[model samples]
Target: MPVNRRITLAARPVGHPQESDFALDEVDVSSPEAGEVLVRVLWTSVDPYQRGRMSEAKSYAPSLQVGDVITAQSVGHVVESNDRRFSVGDLAVGQLGWQEYATARAGTVRPVPEELDPQTLALHAVGMTGLTAYFGLFDVGKPRAGDTVVVSCAAGAVGQIAGQLAKIAGCRAVGIAGGPEKARDLIELYGYDAAIDYKNDGVAEALRGERVDVYFDNVGGEISQAVHRRLNLGARIVICGQVSQYNAERPELSFHPGLLIMFRARMEGFLVFDYAHRYDEAARKLAHWVASGKIRWREHVTDGLENAPRAFIGMLNGENRGKALVKVAERAE
Candidate 1:
């Protein structure tokens, strides 16, 4: 029998996840049933939202139960199959947990193109990060030419793409991030017109009297309030993720309702699952931009599955430069 190693949630975290929250165990790989395939995971994505899942909080998805494998989006290769739709060597992307092997239903996995770079495609510019940026900027925010678009968490996976997309749409892109180096990278590397280091400067003052037409908010809390204060008339705010407050022991600060009433600006929150039907459309456009050198994608990859918890915690602490990923296993040739 083939044995698989898996990381399971040992306890619900009160705030941030610790190493003890997870436990590793070896188990026999059960054969794929009639419509399932056994996948050997290659890479797994560690996103900010997963932090929410660690607690027994109400969310879009259910919280991780004790003893259950920690769930995540992973890209892997099919090593054995009972489903005719998938072949033994096909690479696939799906919601597989942090495991060396997973038996998944056929419908849940999407085959990845052999020509695509699995490392890059699995996380940024071509996957959920790209899709999040595309829909948040174009669909929700609807940035116009000459408009000033501000994105929080600017050096992050979704923020980098969203800022570049704003520039591509002929909008003035302003990114807000932590630290001096990330602020510089946002402008120099990702084509952002300007960047504000929230840790050092006051965000509202840094706006320099410019009215923001669109705010793509990835890190909520005080930053969201600051952006709300500078919103122009009829501006749109797209709420993507709230990484800044993810580790807070208590609920973090929020904006005043009066700001919304006074500015007449609209704020909308969306999940990427809402646009699942249009992923192909977003992927094609993002790929075209990437190929033309119009957009740049960045990733901070950790080399081992055992390091996923550490990487995830560090990401929330602003340790990662871009999308955080764990290389679980090597892709089969």
Candidate 2:
């Protein structure tokens, strides 16, 4: 019997997840049934949002129970199929969990176009990360030309795309990140017009010169509070992810609600699933930007499936530079 290696939640973590929270095991690979395909997983994503699913607390997405297979956006090639839409050797992506091989039923597995590079398209651009940035900025943020757009978590997956999208719309893209290096990448690598190192300087002080017209808040905390303080009248704040507080051991503090009234700005939180039907339209545009050299993509990959838990923890600590993912197996060429 072919064996499948996978990870599961061994225990619920109270604070930052450690290796003890995850358990790796091997099991028999199941064959696909009718309307399903057997996929040999190639790449799997490890996102900050996965941290939220670990707890029993309710979130927009369902919480994962202890001992449950850890789910992530996985890309793989079809090895056997009982579905008409997917033939052997077709590339597909879905929440195939952390297993080396996964069975994906129709509607669960989405086929990847043969022309698109599967490796580059795994979990970053053309996937949830890109879609999140696209919808968060365009739909929720509603940034305008000549607007001063500020993005937090500027070096991470969503923030990088959001900042670039802001610049593409003829806005001044400003970024605030944790480290000096990440701050530099926001400017030198991602094309942000201005970048702030929150670790070294006060984020509010750095942007005191201009009133921000749009704020893309990702790493919510003091950074978000500072940005809120600088919002211009009629500004929009897109609440994306709160990576800063995901691993907190205690209840985190919040900023004053009166700031929104004072600035006459609106703050809205969104989950990308709300606009899933319009993903194709955004993907086409993002793909064009990638092909035309407008958006520079990045992925920090950690080899081996067994290492995913630690890699995920590292990503939570802001160790990865860009989109954090794990390389589980090589895709069939």
Best by TM-score: 2
Clashes of 1: 0
**Against the hidden reference, what TM-scores do the models get?**
0.96, 0.97
Q: Cα lDDT of all candidates, in order?
A: 0.87, 0.87
Per-residue lDDT of model 1, residues 224-288, tens digit only = 88888888998898999988788787877677777778889898999999998898888888887
Question: Residue 239 in model 2: shift from native, Å?
Answer: 0.7
Clash totals in order: 0, 0
Candidate 1 weakest lDDT stretch, 10 residues: 114-123
Candidate 2 lDDT tens digits, 1-75: 489889999999989899999999988987888898999888999988899999877688899998888989998
What stretches of model 2 exceed 4 Å from their correct place?
none
Task: Give candidate 1 regions above 4 Å deviation.
Answer: none
Relative to the true structure, candidate 2 reaches a TM of 0.97
Question: What TM value does model 1 have?
Answer: 0.96
